[model samples]
Target: MCTAAEWDDFRATGTRRPVNFDADGFVHLSTRDQVHLPANRLFGGREDVVLLHLDPARLGAEIRWEPGVPTDPDSMLFPHLYGLLPADAVVAVTPYLPGPDGLFGTPPLP
Candidate 1:
């Protein structure tokens, strides 16, 4: 539930760091690329539980968010990495899975 003002605040921080949540629920700042790759693969393809904060503008690109049925495990390909994203952050979503032939085709923004 991130509000526009809250998003503004985050951006105003003048930092492009990845926020980390520890096992104790404590949050800290880290580099965006510091996020582990395995975590990124975890959420490669998902349908249920709309993930917020997938900003195309931030990505400086256009993409599409095609919702698919949630698969088993209910986890993202790179859960740890993708989970670090802000709950309300907007991303350029593409309905594609990882591995060979990733992201089938280019996703155009709406």
Candidate 2:
């Protein structure tokens, strides 16, 4: 997922990041069922966020499943894309702003 501005940038550029890719050397991804975990943990109260719905098979990167956040036993091995994100992989994009309580809920499937 990306921030609202990042999504805009992706739309404009047509090619997206390899960005932090996480320090583990890839772009971190959360499954549809577990996306809220990372949303609350990482973005928390942030408001300018957006959820990017992507097609796994279309990603140009090498997507790997591995232990992303070690301390969190709930979601240890998450999907990580080991190269740049291509615009073709992004099937949909939606605003993912948090609620008034400053907690984020999962984005609805497109």
Which candidate achieves the best lDDT against the true structure? 2
**Range of the 10 consecutive residues with the lowest summed lDDT in candidate 1:** 27-36
Write one digit per residue (lDDT tens) for candidate 2, span 1-110: 76788888888998776456555576778887667778888889898887888898898778888774655575467887887778888888777877889987766776
lDDT of 1 by residue, 1-110 (tens): 12234445555763223433454232221122322232233433332211123443343322332222254234332112323334334442223233343322222232
Clash count for candidate 2 is 1
Which number leads on TM-score?
2
Cα-based RMSD of candidate 1: 12.7
Residue 101 in model 1: shift from native, Å? 40
Q: Relative to the true structure, how large is the alpha-carbon lDDT of every model?
A: 0.31, 0.78
